[model samples]
Target chain A: MSGLLAVESAGALTTVQDRGRAGLAHLGVPRAGPLDRPAATLANRLVGNDPAAALLEVTWGGLALTSDTGVWIAVTGAPTPVEVAGAGRGSGRAEWLPAGGRLRLGTPVTGVRSYVAVAGGIDVEPVLGSRSTDTLAWVGPPRVQDGALLPVGAPHAPPAPLDTPRPPRPGALRVVPGPRADWFADGALDRLCAASYVVGEESNRVGLRLDGDPPERVRAEELPSEGMVLGAVQVPPGGQPVVLLADHPPTGGYPVLAVVHQDDLWQCAQLRPGDPVGFARLRGA
Target chain B: MDVLDLRAFGPAAVLAEVADSAAARSLAAYARAARVDAEEVVPGARTVLFDGVRDVDGLARRLADWTPDGGPERGPLVEVPVVYDGADLHDVAARWGTDVDGVVARHGEIEFVSAFCGFAPGFAYLAGLPEEHAVPRLDTPRGRVPAGSVGLAGSWCGVYPTASPGGWRLLGRTELTLWDPARYDPALLAPGTRVRFVPV
Candidate 1:
């Protein structure tokens, strides 16, 4: 049976997200999806939802919701406080909430974003084949707001067993040498890997802006706009590297020094402001 | 049919530099038609980026002998009606060494093709303008240019798909929705589509 949930108090930034819209970059559409794919997938699996099913991606939690019908749900990513109907309930495991029962998620003790997956998933209407709210282009459904009513699709898959928490690995993010590495001065890649960078406060879904020694460039002229891929580490005029994320622009004019490995992108998503980050080069695939 | 260079963008994608924008567009069109294993066949100023490449070696071989198919000829003619009332209308006319009416006449006479879409969703970079008509961008961009605001920069013309900061030289405004997520086709001006600006 279909279910409905009402948002009581939306968090600092909450939006519906799924696997994201693809094959539309040529049309200038950003690939808007869950920043943490593994966490989102785990949350969906715990609740017996499709891996690509839409869910609530809460940033810095404060989300409170009550379903009209009993539903199965799970919260994953950035271990946070989760309570069901006033009782403390742990996250990362499927839990049943009786009809009229509320689910509240408190601020994360550490991480930056969290995922909440319902059995049937967030059934908001899909745009461009995804329900993900693109914070940059303002594409897809509107952001979840206080008192907003969310539709839940009928459950499909069976719930899976709770697996061990897979926290983001610590240490340096891995990188592959660039499509535009020549634009930088000699030893630029070495310099980038040698120095530690702090996550800038201005970072968002578009990119993770960094505060560190700006990589010096040999090319001073403006580079004509070129296609940018996810994980592209583009160095703007300021010299600081900005790692392109899920909602980054499809094309950019700045030269890319390197690209972070896709597997390590989750760490970039979870990095909080002021967190230190280092890059490690991965050669010859 | 000559390929200038092929450089690895990352582990998966490659940027193939070609002769010109037309060649880049042709390559992108051919790749999409041939169902290349790449996820995105994106055309830029003078290069095409084949992203999410599944068979890098296979693609490399295909690109080695890639011949330019006359250029993209998909999609229908999209007429954009403009009011010719923009913040930089006079500035654009001044740069063109022409009066407001002359500028409108010159802009309306050309048939522009959607060379690429970037900067913002649904913002297609329309090409076909002669080199003599090239215009410069604003020294300082406006914080927000409303959606449907038509503008020109360098040798390209485009309409802002959504309200955002831009530095293009404004020429007019169109009422048509350049992008609509609710529609079956979100982007009104997909690449290769023919576009005409009508002065209303």
Candidate 2:
């Protein structure tokens, strides 16, 4: 029988996400997945499974639950402290959750999201080639409703827990010149890396609306909506930078200034409403 | 067919725009080439995306040595039956200087092609709406357009394979499921797949 866990309380923005939906954007399905990839990867490693295993993506970090059977569980990402029966389960690391043990994820300390991984994986019907919860599309096969039993997979093989996680060094995110890089009159790329940009409140899983000092736009002409990619830095008429993210539409009309590197995308995912950020140009291929 | 203004967009994507009809066909032509096996291409109402493998030199050569599909017969012409009654029926009818019944007859007569599939999963940019039936998008698009709700947005018309937020004026509904993950062919409409409307 699969390990089952009952959902007690799911935090705001909690959604089931895996590696991501691939090869489907052309049909208009945006890739919906975890904001923090390495964290999600770490969580899966703690449970002895593939890094792409389905995990519960909890944003603003407040998830609580109880396992219905004996199973392994690990919590990763952010500084959301975990506990079993009021005893600390550790934060920024992974731990085992015995059967009938209570697991609680407190508020996030610095990051915007965290992921909880079970021994197997979150067993859910794959919709449109993904287990990612696309709230915008309502293709969510199921949500973390209280008392709803979450189905797990085969038991994990006996193994030692992962080594203590070291925090990532915060640095400026790197980006490649976007498809519409030349739309700007001249030295727009220079100013993009020169100035620090802040994350805006209007941002979500769809895309990040960057604030801070604005990037100047040389042109002010109407643009037809064209294909948009994740990490694409599109400057609207107002010159405010919009960094596309997971769940981004297939197309947009704005001129793309730059594209954030896939490896550095986690920085954009961890940004809060007022977090300041800087861009670094990724040279060459 | 009238050729529209072609503009260079992303180093990866291009836009061949037209005010209406004659250009929709030519735009569809480039869309066919852009959407080959090796290259990742996405077609829109008027623009097409040619992304990945950033060999601008190779792309120019490929286009220079290109061959058209001859005609729409390369792909099967799929007929979609839909009810010609939507929330925007009256509004669309008036724009065409006709009643609701007249709009249905004209709409069903033309052949529409899969110009592109974007906006949502399996949602296609279908061209071939009659000139008179064409109208601009709504001032404010509806937050949720139900799946299978056939509608016309400007000179283009298409079915909502997946429910999403859109501004197209609806004319009816259909039973064909365009997107299904489990199915061998998820999207019923593929580029080059021909489309014809039938009033159900």
Candidate 3:
């Protein structure tokens, strides 16, 4: 009858996420929510939950859940081999789990994250019009810990046995040149469009630190600190690019080289460590 | 401030630059100029956001080509009570080659304006930290900076809305909650909101 599934095993970096808190960046709040927005939305729709309902965002894929009351739920994204009471969950799949039946999420197969949505939705106190967890500035609580009983609220409508799996990530990401695109040398734009960068080991929710050819700066003047956006790719002194993620800071000093298109944000979120990333030009229709 | 050219940020957002002493003043100007029909008008340390469902390109082009009415001289001053006791206070002064009083005076002299919001909710990027007062961030960032903590690094200053790990030197704390989600305006200080700090 409740909305939230109890946290039996809260894997690394698992947090409650929804559509994300926007329009508050002027107040210094970065939009922190599910890295894979489409997947979260799909999972929500499958369980007959609201589009903005909060679900568990499991990164590096390791989580387990059990319900106090029997509920219908669905698992999607990253092709995780989900098991409910010893049954497997595939892409675009829905299954019913009885009360106290264990729901487990194994390791990531294709992508790096997975979303598990309940029939109702997780009912946690929302901060700033959002139930999404922001760990960088303590805006929300840290990753869910073991033995934490999440309160599952009632669904807006009865559970639907519908199957709506998210579309697979596109092959390439369309990125727009940065506001400071002129800061780079003549060939910098070509290099950005030509090079294949890898997600470095030092990446996190705050930002994705990339490892690749260091681009030359055309205008190296010390820039005044300014506001940054989620998915803004800024290159530090070393020339490596740092892709700003959902939990990025309110402002930064580095020069932005490019910004990943909002549509491809899920692909950027699913990029595992050492994954190759090649930037493509964004063309308006 | 003169109206500059507009640039498209993304599918739903458009932005314009106001390369001035303080981005707050111009941001406020833009906010007032587009007062109506804007889904959201967000200002930051050095940028302003016009996000929503309208004609993003048309609005951006209009913003780039139109002149502003020079809105209120950006005069919403918020006096923050500080204790002047940050963990990195003493060291920051030394790096800037200034005495404690000198640092305090510089910190209070000019009114700081909200330029942008980014890292965390309610984290205001306060502009107007004098160039001389600016110092490089700590080599290794501090593990935690408490709520309402004032910090300075590089060319900007900021107040930690919540307890967060930061690299900026902390000089003091305040009782005022910069950000409380339950409130109508969660972040106490918003872009163009003047910040006037007074020692406790």
- Fnat: each model in turn: 0.78, 0.47, 0.58
Instruction: Summarize candidate 3's per-residue lDDT along A1-285 as a digit string, tens digits.
Output: 364477778888788888777766566666688888888888888888999888888887779888878787888778887888887756555678789888998998878888888877887778777888876765664568888888777877766666645558566667888767788987686688799888888887788788999888988777655556667889899899998888887567788878888788888778888988888888752
What is the C-alpha lDDT profile of model 3 across B84-159, one tens digit per residue? 8887778877977887776677677778877666667777777777676678888998887788889887777888
Which residue segments of model 1 deviate by more than 4 Å? A283-285, B1-4, B69-75
Candidate 1: pairs in clash:
none
State how far residue A263 of model 1 sits from its true place (Å): 0.8
Give the Cα RMSD of candidate 2. Answer: 4.2
I-RMSD for candidate 3: 2.7
Question: Candidate 2 on B1-200: residue-level lDDT in tens?
Answer: 33334443334444444543223434455645465432445555555555543665555445544433344444568999898779998998898989999888888888887766767777777876756667888899999988999988867888988777889999999988888867776778865577988998
TM-score list, all predictions: 0.96, 0.85, 0.87
Which model, 2 or 3, shows the larger lDDT? 3
Q: Rank the candidates by TM-score, best first.
A: 1, 3, 2
Q: lDDT per residue, candidate 1, A154-176, as tens digits?
A: 99876675677676676788888
The alpha-carbon lDDT assigned to residue B23 of candidate 1 equals 81
Q: List lDDT for all candidates, in order.
A: 0.89, 0.73, 0.75
Candidate 2 chain A, poorest ten consecutive residues by summed lDDT: A157-166
Query: After best superposition, candidate 3 residue A133: deviation in angstroms?
Result: 0.8
Model 2 misplaced regions, further than 4 Å: A156-160, A164-167, A212-222, B1-41, B45-70, B130-133, B162-164
For the predicted complex of model 1, DockQ is 0.81
